[model samples]
Target: MSIKIRGSNAYGHSGWFTVYCRICNRKLKIGTDLVYKCPKCEKKYNAYFCEADARGLKWKCPYCNTELVPVI
Candidate 1:
């Protein structure tokens, strides 16, 4: 089984990316929507949250207990 990951430059594709809120599964748009990322463990956990979800989480990384940072 092979898992294909879609990411900016994931397959030599540039200038394209999509993010989603881990909590509610809402699609997040950069620049247009406020986003938060967990710096301490984002690489491993892939934690991304939209504004409302981030606030609901108290701006903390649920996995690592690290404070979340704004994407912008």
Candidate 2:
């Protein structure tokens, strides 16, 4: 997947934003929000996904079944 930087002044902060999921071409909304980064697939999500729900202790991506690395 590819990552892109999108910026806006909606939150009054100006900077580069890292966006994941190239296939989906998704853009992040401008605001204070939370995201869970998947290590293997390098995907981002809005909610907390448990390892069990993600299907293993390896912290894999729920969408691609690849191991996920948490970014906080």
Candidate 3:
């Protein structure tokens, strides 16, 4: 079964995406190439792309529980 993504984060083929907070409406900038930090809300999401990552890992928003899926 294919996982469904319901949040504002759109996954692309580039294998990179910026996480956004619906409450804060702010674009999260990638820092340190590891930790995903929300500048405005100061909330950290486990940034995961639904796109084709080598490991085929899955990710969801910690606060909202929105599934991240590929936009294809």
Candidate 4:
């Protein structure tokens, strides 16, 4: 499964992009707009802005030691 960003001219932005979780192969609802970064590996991820404070489940990328950021 893979997430794909879609649409055009969304919320004043030039493109209407949506977040899809590749593992789940589903389009994630945009409850909020925010981006996150992993402190360990310096990788970046996107999630709903409202979920920023939620404790993240332990997950890591196979190729890197950095914690995987959750996408809402």
Clashes of each: 0, 4, 0, 1
TM-score of 2: 0.30
List ranges where model 3 is wrong by over 4 Å: 1-15, 32-72
TM-score of each: 0.73, 0.30, 0.22, 0.35
lDDT of 4 by residue, 13-66 (tens): 523445544333344444455433344433254322223222332354433445
Tens-digit lDDT string for candidate 3 (1-72): 998764455454222545543334444434422323223223344343322331233344444545443322
Of the two candidates 2 and 4, the one with more favorable lDDT, higher being better, is 2
Worst 10 residues of 3 by lDDT: 49-58
Return whichever of 2 and 4 wins on TM-score: 4
Least well predicted 10-residue stretch by lDDT in candidate 4: 46-55
The candidate maximizing lDDT is 1
Instruction: Sort by lDDT, best first.
Output: 1, 2, 4, 3
Error of 1 at 4 (Å): 26
Residue pairs with backbone overlap in model 4: 3-20
Once superposed on the true structure, which residue ranges of model 4 sit more than 4 Å away at CA? Answer: 1-7, 10-15, 32-57, 70-72
Cα lDDT of model 1 by residue, 1-72, tens digit: 998878764685534556878889888777778889999877776788999988888988889888999987
lDDT of candidate 4? Answer: 0.40
